[model samples]
Target: MSTGPGILAPVTALGAATLRLLGEMGAMFLFLADGLRLIFASPKQIPKILNQVFVIGSKSLFVILLIGVFTGMVLGLQGYYTLVKFGSEGLLGAAVALSLIRELGPVLTAIMVTGRAGSSMAAEIGVMRITDQIDALDVMDINPMAYLVSPRIAASLISFPLLTAVFDVVGILGGYVTGVTLLGINEGVYFYRIQTSVEMADITGGFMKSLLFAVIVATVSCYQGYFTHMRRDGVGPEGVSNSTTSAVVLSCVFVLVADYALTSFLL
Candidate 1:
C-alpha cells in the first residue's frame, strides 16, 4: 500500500529540517576552523585581538563581579543553614569554594559574557552582512574572517580564563562576607577549609570549562551573525535581531551542555 501525501509531508519536512541542521553544523565547523586559522596568520592582528579583549573582557567586568559576589553570598547563606542542620556549618567554606571554583564561577561567567558580548558580536556582524559591508571587505581584498572573526576568537581564548578567575575570586570573597561576617562562622576556619579542600585540579577544571565556553560563545555568535543574510526567518534588521537572539540562546545552551560533558570528564 502506498503512503498518503499527508503521511509523506511530515516525513519530508522532518528530513529537510534534519538536513538543514546538519548543514548548518558543518558550516559552523568550517567557519570556526577558518577563523582559528587566520587568528595567528599575521602579527597585525594583535591590536585587533587586544581591542576585542577590551570589548569582551573589560566591558564585562562589572557585571561579572556583581553576579559573582551575589551568587557566592547566596550560596553561603544557604550552605550555612543547610550545614547547621547537620552540625557541619564549619564546612561551609569548602562547600562554597568547591561549588564556585568547580562549576558556578565558570558557567555563570560564560553565560554573562554571552548575554553581553555575544549579542553584540552577532548584531554587529549581522548588520555588516545585511549592509553588504562584508562584501565591501571582499572587494577590498581583505580577509573578512581574519579582519572580523579571528580577533574575537583569539580574544575570547585569552579573556575567558581571566574573567573566570575574577569571578571565582570575587565570589569567594562574597562567601566570606556572608559566612564569616554575617553568619558568624569563624574567619580562620573558612579560609582554612578553603585552602585545604580546594586543589589545583579543581581550579584547572574550572578554567578549562571557561575556555570551552568562550569558544562556544564566540563561534556561535559569529557564525549566526556572519550568515544573517541567509536566514529564512527574516532579513535586514529583523534578521539581525533574530540572529542576536539565537546567538545568546544557543551560546547559553551550549555552555550548559558543554559544562555537563566537561564535568563528567573532569570528575
Candidate 2:
C-alpha cells in the first residue's frame, strides 16, 4: 500500500511536467497566431520591419562571412584529402558545393544568427517583460505583438534565407580557394564540376529550409522573452537569464531537428 503512493508520485510528476510543456507549446502557438493576425492588421509597421531586417541581416553579415569562409576552407581541405585517396579529387568542388548548398550553409547560418541576434532578442524582450514595458503598451492600447514581435518575425523570415544564400556563396568561394590554390587542383575542373552538378533545386530547397528555421528561431526567442515570469526556480534578472539561455538552446535544438525532417522530406 505504501509502495503504491511512492510509485504514483513519480507518475504524477511526469504527468504534470508533460502538461506544463504542452501548455507552453500551446501558448506559443497562440502567440504566433496573434503575431500573424496583427502583421496584416497593421501594415503601417513597414519601417519597423525594415529596421529589423537591417539589424537581423546586415548586422550578422560579418559573422556569417567569417563562419562561411572557415567552414568552407575546412571542408575543402578535408574533402580534398579524402577524394585524393579515392583518386577522385576533381570532384572535390561538386562535393563541397553540394554539401554547403544542401546542408551546412543553412544550418550554420541559423546557429550563428541564433547565437548572436536571437539571444539579444530574448534578453531585450525579457527585460521588457520584467520592467512591465509590455504592460505599458497595453495601457496605451498598443498591440505589442504587432509593434514589437511581428516585425522581428517577419524580418527573420526574410533575413535567414538571404543570409543562408550568402553563406552558400561565400562557402563555395572558400572551397574553391582552398581546393584550387592550396590543393593544386585545376581551377577550371573545380568550377566546372560544381557548376554542372549543383542545381537550382539544391539552392531552392536549402533556402526553404532556412526560411523554416528562421521561423523557429524568432518564435522561440520571442516567446521565451515575452512570457518571462518571476518564479522560485529563477525569476527577475535570473528569469531573463534563464529565458535567454532557453531561447538559444531551444532554437538550436529545433533547427537541427527541423533540418533532419526537412532533409528527409526534400532530399
Candidate 3:
C-alpha cells in the first residue's frame, strides 16, 4: 500500500496529539491515586504531612503577607484614582476585595508557592532519581510513590488553602489601610463596604481554586522528577535540570489555565 504525504500527515498529527493527551491523563490519574493512597495509608504520616505543610505553607506566610499588602495597596491606589475620575471612589473597597478574593489572591499565592516549594521538590526528587535512591526503595519493597510523592501532595493540599486564607486577610487589611489612612476614606465605610459587598461565594471560590492549584503544582513537580530517567547516557544532569524547569513552568501554566476554567464553571 502506498500513501501520499497529505493523506498521512493529518492522521499522524491526530495520533500524536491523542497520545500526548492520553499520557497526560494517565499521569494525572496516577498522581491522584498516589495522593489518595498517601492520605489513607498510615496515621503516622499525618504528623509528617503536617510538618511538611508547615514547611511549605506556614513558612511562606511572610511572603504571602508581604505580597498581599503591596498588592492591596497598589490596587487601592489605582482603583481609588480610577473610581474618583468616575465619581465612584466609594466603590474602592468593593473593587479591591472582589479582585483580591476572586482572582489575584489565589493565583498569586499559587505562583509564589510553586516557585518556592514546587521547584525544590522537583530538584530534590530529581537528584534522588539520578542517585538511584528511588531504585533502592524498589529493592527494599517500598513504594517510592507513596514515600516521596504522597507527602508532598498531602502537604500541598493542606497548605495551599491555608496560604490562600492568609492572603485573603492580609490583602483586605492592606486595602483597608490604603483606603483609610493613605487615601483619606472613612475606615467604617471601607470596612462596611467590603463586609457587605464580599459574598461567601467569593471566599469559597478562591479556596477551591487554591486547592486545585495545590494538586496541580504537586503532581506536575513530582511527575517530572519521578519520571526522570537519568541513566540515558548524555541525558543525566541535563535531563534532571530540564525536568525541574519543566515542572515549574508547567505548574504555573496549569494553575492559570485551571483558574480560568474553574472560574468560568463556578462563577
Candidate 4:
C-alpha cells in the first residue's frame, strides 16, 4: 500500500526536476548572452576567433566528406529504387538534390561538427577548468568568457554554415555519380530537373537552420565545460568526460528538435 509521504514523493521529485530544468535554461540563456556580448567587446579577439574558425571549420572537412559522400550515395541508391517502382526514376536527380539542399546537408553537417568540434571544445574547456587554468586567468584579472568562450561561439556560428555549404556541394556530386554513372539514369534530365525544382528559398532556409544549430551546439558545449565540477573539490578527467558526453548528446537532441520546428515553420 502507498503511504501519504510515498505518494507525495513522486510529485515532489517531478517538481524538483522541472525546477532544475527551468533554472538551467535560464542560466544558459544568460551565459549565451554574456558570451555574445564578450565577442564584440573591445579588442575584438579577432585573431583567436579566426584561428578557432579555421580549427573548428577546416579540421572537420575530411569527416564531412566521408559522411556527405556516403549519405548522398545512399540517398541516391534508395531514392532511385523507390522511384523506379513507379517508373518515375526520372525524378531521382530532383529528389536527391532537394533532400541534400533542403534538409540533410545542413542537419548532418551540424551533427557531424557537433560530434567533432563540439566535443573537442567541451573537452578542452573541461580540462582547463579541472587543471585550474581558468582560475589562473581570473587571478590575472582576465575575463575568461572573452578570452576563452566567445571566440569558440563565434567560430561555430561562422564555420557551421560554410562547412554546410561544402557538404551540400559534395553531397550533390556524390548523388550525381550514383544516379548517373552507377544507376544509368539520364544525366541531362537529372541536372535539368534539379535546376528547375530547387529554389533559393530552400538553400537559404537550410542555411538559417544551420546557423541556429551552431548557436545551440556552441552554447551547450561551452556551458558543459564552464560548469562541470571535479570530484574532490573541482573537476577531474571523469568529470570532463561526462560533461563532454552530455554536451554532445544535448546538442544533438536540440539540433533535431530545432530542425523539426524550423522545417515545420519554414517549409
* CA displacement after TM-score superposition, residue 201 of candidate 3 (Å): 1.6
Best-first order by TM-score? 1, 2, 4, 3
- Full-model lDDT, candidate 3: 0.87
Output the number of the TM-score-best candidate: 1
Greater TM-score among 1 and 4 belongs to: 1
Question: Cα miss at 18, model 3 (Å)?
Answer: 3.6
Lowest lDDT 10-mer window, candidate 3?
A: 227-236
Give the winner by lDDT.
Answer: 1
Predicted candidate 1 versus true structure: per-residue lDDT over 1-267, tens digit per residue: 987999889889999999998998899989999999999899999999999999999999999999999999999999999999999999999999999999999999999999999999999999999999999999999999999999999999999999999999999999999999998999999999999999999999999999899899999999999999999999999999999999999999989999999999999
- Each model's Cα RMSD: 0.9, 1.3, 2.2, 2.0
How many clashing residue pairs are found in candidate 2? 0
lDDT tens digits, residues 1-267, model 3?
888999989999999999988987796777777676877688777787887898789888898999999999989999998999998888889999999989999999999998888888888888899889999999999888778888889999999998988887888889888888988998888888898999999889999999899899989888888877832433668878888888899999999999989999996
What TM-score does structure 2 among the candidates reach? 0.96
**Clash count, one per candidate:** 0, 0, 0, 2
lDDT of 2 by residue, 180-245 (tens): 989899999999999999999999999999999998999999998988874345889999999999
Instruction: Kindly report which residue stretches of model 4 are placed more than 4 angstroms away from their true locations once superposed.
Output: 1-3, 230-234
Model 4: per-residue Cα lDDT over 1-267, one tens digit each = 657887788899999999989999999999999999999987769999999998899999999999998888998999999999999998988898889988999899999999999999999999999889999999999999999899999999999999898888888888889999999998999899899999999999989998999999999999999887732333598889889999999999999999999999996
Per-residue lDDT of 226 in model 4: 89
Using alpha carbons, what is the TM-score of model 4?
A: 0.96
